[model samples]
Target: MNYFNYKRRLSSETRIGDIPLGGTNPIRIQSMTNTNTNDTEASAEQVIRIVEAGADYVRLTAQGVREAENLRNIKEVVRSKGYKTPLIADIHFNPRAAEAAARIVEKVRINPGNFVDRVKTFENFEYTDEEYALEIEKIRAKLIPLLNICKEHKTAIRIGVNHGSLSDRIMSRYGDTPEGMVESCMEFLRICVEEGFSDIVISMKTSNTVVMSQAVRLLVQCMDKEGLSFPLHLGVTEAGDGEDGRIKSAVGIGSLLADGLGDTIRVSLSEDPEYEIPVARKLVAYIKERENHPEIVAEAYAGYSPFDTSRRETYAVENIGGENQPTVISDRSNGNFELNSHFLPDYIYVGKELPLAAPRAIPSIIDVEGWKNGKNTYPLFTSVNYKEIKGNAATIKFLRLSYAELTEEVLSLLKEDTTIVVILTTSHVNGVGEQRAFIHTLMNNNCKTPVVFNRGYKENETEDLQIKAAADFGTLFLDGFGNGIMLQNEGSIALKSIDAYMFGILQASRVRTSKTEYISCPSCGRTLFDLQTTVALVKEATSHLKHLKIGVMGCIVNGPGEMADADYGYVGAEKGKISLYKKKNLIEKNIPSGEAVQRLVQLIKDNGDWVEPDNN
Candidate 1:
């Protein structure tokens, strides 16, 4: 299979500076500078560092004309220092800044949510269809000058649509949904087409991975209906730091990339911009590898819309579904029964022929050739033998079903045995979809058998294997499907690592919370302190606080806004100063940087949100 042709939907090629996108070009990696744009030296230095760290493009925030005017100087300084990385001006609610920056930078990004909505007010009034048409004309008139400037300068444009920032008009009409995000970008995209400007890259971003992925899919679908194939830039906006961030980004961006979507990707981490490049490289490389693999192209079920989620209704199977959290099963077979404290799985499954005995305390699933009583475990029977073992009287019975080989008669057994929990396994090209199709079949027949999704992999590298497994399982979980997960790795990767990954995927999917959640922003020039060090310190102090969400932001831009969903917030106000927030309310202001973390701990204590770390 040709790598470019396999499963990929190609878009028209567009040029930004020296590099091109879409067509056969590699998926580009990009990062934005957080420094104050008016500080040319600092901005230029940050851009250089980002480029050196392997980013193909660099973006700078242009909030006003002063910062926009300084772009020329920054570009000159960067070029003089021998960096040719493309520069992008990130414009929000400043069309004049966009116009000025377009003349100097290779690209200009405008948020359609705020580009022409000058009043910045939220309203809830019904508008007639004719009035809506007039509103579009009025907004387009305001955007014409920026479009003209871009067309004249050959500067590419990215119509970036954010889920949280959709305009009041869009919200009132579409109700802050994926459809709203798509419509927000489409409104501007149509205007660009009318102005004869085709050098455009479009993006749909959200902190919610499901919404982000769905919005991008819908954008592509709507664009396809109109015969428009603009290149797509993919990112999960405000994806927090560390393991959680990586898994969430992989699930969102990687899922789309798997389907041959995305012309470029940016893994938005709450770390340094330089740190984002490697993760992006790894993800893009994986997609390229999959492109060459024969199993990459799988048919999607037309009945199942990629733009929406429908979790299969399932009854509880002993704390596995319904009101309980999704369970994790470990493959503790292969004669290895030494359970490690770090990798505690909910259940363990052992093969029938294995000689190792089940541990007394740990719950186990034992595969039996014939009906035999096992200690501290339940018998796992095959679909063909389910009827034979129906009278086994075990509290929980597991029936393993092959996705490719499942039959209606086997499914009919569920009606006879309500205690039988089905574990769906697949050896098909599209394992995820195959498993999903099984659930669809069950739902169509109104069979409410609780299904546990299982996948087997044989990769040696831990990170690569984690990425693969996370993508396979995380996508389904995002759609509110699956009652549990079972992973079987053939390699010698640490069992503890797999354990961490399974829980990490679950936590990232927002299905469960096992540790403190950090919504840290990727630091830029605008950051007031050493963001990496501060984040590490905070994590060290709060890692034991289960279910707590703490936001560690570098600046005010994404701090108050992105962390609005967090339980508590730590935002930088200025050099050597920090602000503390409880939910969205400011509880404390301008504390010295050295004392901020302690104050945050005390604040948590005051709110009765603190707990002594298990070993702090």
Candidate 2:
């Protein structure tokens, strides 16, 4: 795939029931049921709801052969009710269940991490070359049966790899990195090809958006080198509920989709499965608009690496770059600047006039004409006026320039000025690519001035703005391209909403964190308690802890391993019990579900990681 061009990665078409995916097919949206698979009535009903909500496919967890067999009953019920949407059986650590489901459902998803290899113990062990070859043979021996089953039944297969659930064998070789994740899937894909089974889909998921995006991109690169092209299934596993989940999903999944990678997508949320479809649909619709986007003419930067998260090196101009966290610049150019919320922006761009009562601590950006030599105020000059103000510029100045404006002369001038921070903007339809091109130019020219992305949105809904901005800005941040972000909306959305989302984009990108990050999984049949309700209780109790990451998983299937980056974990242990974890290590086992939240809180306190919520 061309990094600066808009072209979907073409893959062989794979038929899943009546809906075909990849190749020339439209991107498909899917969701999974949280109801117990054995409770066929509830599971079937949820699947119908998801289908009605615009899901092209629905999946249910098949932990054992019993649940796998029950999938046939669920499919029968849905078929009887007139919903012909393709059904996918989600299998983890159970080849028998995958074999059973492959014969019953339209598709079967098996995690390559544990389908054959043992569950991850995170224990490091050495693997000799011959030993590793033996392990691959083991995988081939186990996976061939499932591939034959799939081919015989005409059922598609998804070799899903999760970052948190990488096998001990893979970790021993690749150390739980993107390379390991890609190799995990490739090992299975190669086996499928050897078996002449071509009906397959692929996914690389993680709660960490950075790792998730990187792994998927790396997977594509590896696949291209070997000439394999299976349809991609995109998602950010364990993305928590509400706006955060939406933003995080968009950041991870949208980044890949923007690169023309995903063939099918699911917006995983800690809510009813049906609710995820609309968000997934909205995300797909947002990216689809770029399919025919105007051409972006640029060469890939020689210094840029697409597969890693290395911030583009730049000197700090004030606190906007270098070692500082990525700053947020609120566009209050309409003059409604009021620092009313806890989520404060590091800078405010007020266009021409600084708000009379604007706080002095938060720097303000003004048009070059209105910029006075005052404390905490900076001038924003366009390419045309930058030279004129260069001599009399403030100690810290903002230069607004598009990719086309970064001429040789401007590059030379920027290299000489240590005080200027470039505010990068783009009018092109492929704004992310254009802005990225601008950064690459600066990097190649050896300019150390910090560049802040300035994107303007008009007449868009709040959710649309969130998804779009996160995709655009989050993509750059993930690629290590920006030092700050300026989100400008001329729509009717509140400034506070925009402020919150700006921080959200930063947090989702893993560049900055201004609030508590939750890595809660979308509940499935294996979930032990009321996941939705439990997440709410956990959030309400722990939301004040801004510097922490908490994982609320419904069951052990998505337990410690899935929430690998989380500082604390609340995993379901039994029907009415919960397991609390300090990182990946078990803290307390099987606490009653009713007391899990308080117990988790007490666990945080016990570890001295808790702080009293400020009532002020």
Candidate 3:
């Protein structure tokens, strides 16, 4: 991958119905239906809605041979309605269903983590070389049947692996790590290749943006090493609803898209499936705009590793770098402002004057001419004027610099100043790459000045701003760069909205946490209960637990394994029943649906993790 250049990764094309993916084709957008597969009309209607909402493909869950057979009826209905969009069947744990679905739909998605392996026991078991080889042979034996079916029907298969569901065989060998996720997918791909089957698409999905992005990068690297160039599918599974969902999905999927990695993408949200299409479209369009951009000339920095998630090493500058959580700097330079106590920014940049009535505790950044040495105030200097404070005794200062301003003199000045926090910005069309080059230059020159990423968007729509900003800043943060973020927008977007988005991007990148993080999966046919309503109920009850990570999964298929990192889980065990979990450990089972929310609250309180919501 080129850290400073914008170029798409070339991959072998795979056909799914009429639309082909990868190679020189455009990046495709897709979504799945939540309607019951057995209800042909409802499923077909939902599929049409998704397709009409700008999706190139639509998928429906097939949990058994029965649902798999129903896909034929759904397909017939959709085709009769004059829609030629490709249909995909999402299968988990059942080989018979995958085989049956392969004969019906354009594509069949099988989870390699559970397709043939036994359900995860979370046990510590060891496997010798012979045992591991036997396991692979077992997987091959089961997978060959589906491979033959796909080949016979000319159906593309996606070896989708989720972070939460690695089989015990893999966990015992590789643990629940990104490398393990790669091996899980690779194991199946190798068998497909051995069987002379090439209609393949691959995905690595997880709720954690960092893990999802890293695993996909590693998957590409592993595939390249083995002489494979299969088209990749990207998504962050269980990425909640509303702004949180949109921002999180963009952060993960957009980062990969910016690297020119993904061939097709899905924005998984807890909202209606059709609503997910626009967000996915917006994200894809935003990244595609960088194609054929002006060349960014720079070599990859040896000090930075794209595969690693460690923060770049730099000395502390008060609370801006080193061990500090990345700060948030609000761009209030336009003078329209409101201070939000719950979402207050660490600092506000007021072009030339400090607000007369604003609190002084949260520092303000004034322009160089407006520097009056007020309490907790810092001056903003361009690279040219930064030298005026060469020997000053100020505790901290903000120096705004762009990629072109990083010269030898600036590098020397940065190295000499321990109090300078560089505010990095870029005007190039390939902003992420340009800003990344700035960071790489600093690292290569051995400069330790803490740097904050600043980006401005002219988008008028909230979703567009969210998608664009998240992609820009999220790319840097996910790569373990940036000491803080400064988001500026010239549109009619409210200040509070921008403030919230800044924090949302930070939290989505896993660099900071300012609100509750919900890992809620999008509903599918296998879901035992109403996911959307249940999610809202759960959030209403526990949204105040700012520090807790909660998982609200639809069914057991995505329950324990997908939310592996969550602190608590509310999963559907069966019809009208809910199960509670504490970090993958089941605590309560078969609670009535009506009583589940209160019980979840009680469980949190019992575990000493609950907090009362502030009514103020």
Q: Candidates' TM-scores?
A: 0.87, 0.98, 0.99
Per-residue lDDT over 1-616 for candidate 3, one digit per residue giving the tens place of the 0 to 100 score: 8888889999999989999989999999999999999999999999999999999999999999999999999999999989999999999889999999999999999998899987877888899999999999999889999998888899999999999889998899899899999999999999999999988999999999999988999999999999999999999999999999999999999899999999999999998999999999889888888889999877567877888999998888889898899999998887766777778999999887786765678788888787787688888889779788686556888999999998888889899888899999888999999998998888888888899999988978999999999988999999999999999989998888899999999999999999999999998888889999999999999998999999999999879988789999999999999999999899999999999999999999999997788899
* Weakest 10 consecutive residues of candidate 2 by summed lDDT: 333-342
Q: Candidate 1: global Cα-lDDT?
A: 0.80
Per-residue C-alpha lDDT of model 1 across residues 506-539, encoded as one tens digit per residue: 8777777776778777776567888889998898
The C-alpha local distance difference test score for the whole of candidate 2 amounts to 0.89
> What does candidate 2's lDDT look like per residue over 1-616, in tens digits?
6777778999999989999999999999999999989998998889999999999999999999999999989999999989999999999989999999999999999998889877678788999999999999999888999888888899999989988889988898888698889989999999899889998999999988888888988888888888988899999999989999999999999899889999999999999989999888888887788777787777677877888688888999879889889989998877776664669998888888777867778888889888888888888889889786558758888889998898888888899988888899988888887887777777777778898998988845877898889988898899888889898888898897899999999999999999999999998889889888988998999999999999999888758898778999999988899999998899899899988899999999999999999888
Look at candidate 1 and give me any clashing residue pairs: 34-524, 34-525, 34-526, 35-525, 35-526, 270-521
Pairs with backbone N, CA or C atoms under 3 Å apart (clashes), candidate 2:
none
Going through the candidates in the order shown, the clash numbers are 6, 0, 1
Candidate ranking (TM-score, best to worst)? 3, 2, 1
lDDT of each: 0.80, 0.89, 0.91
Which residue runs of candidate 1 sit more than 4 Å off their true CA positions? 1-6, 34-54, 77-83, 116-138, 168-176, 225-227, 289-304, 334-343, 352-359, 370-375, 382-388
User: Sorted by lDDT, highest first, which candidate order results?
Assistant: 3, 2, 1
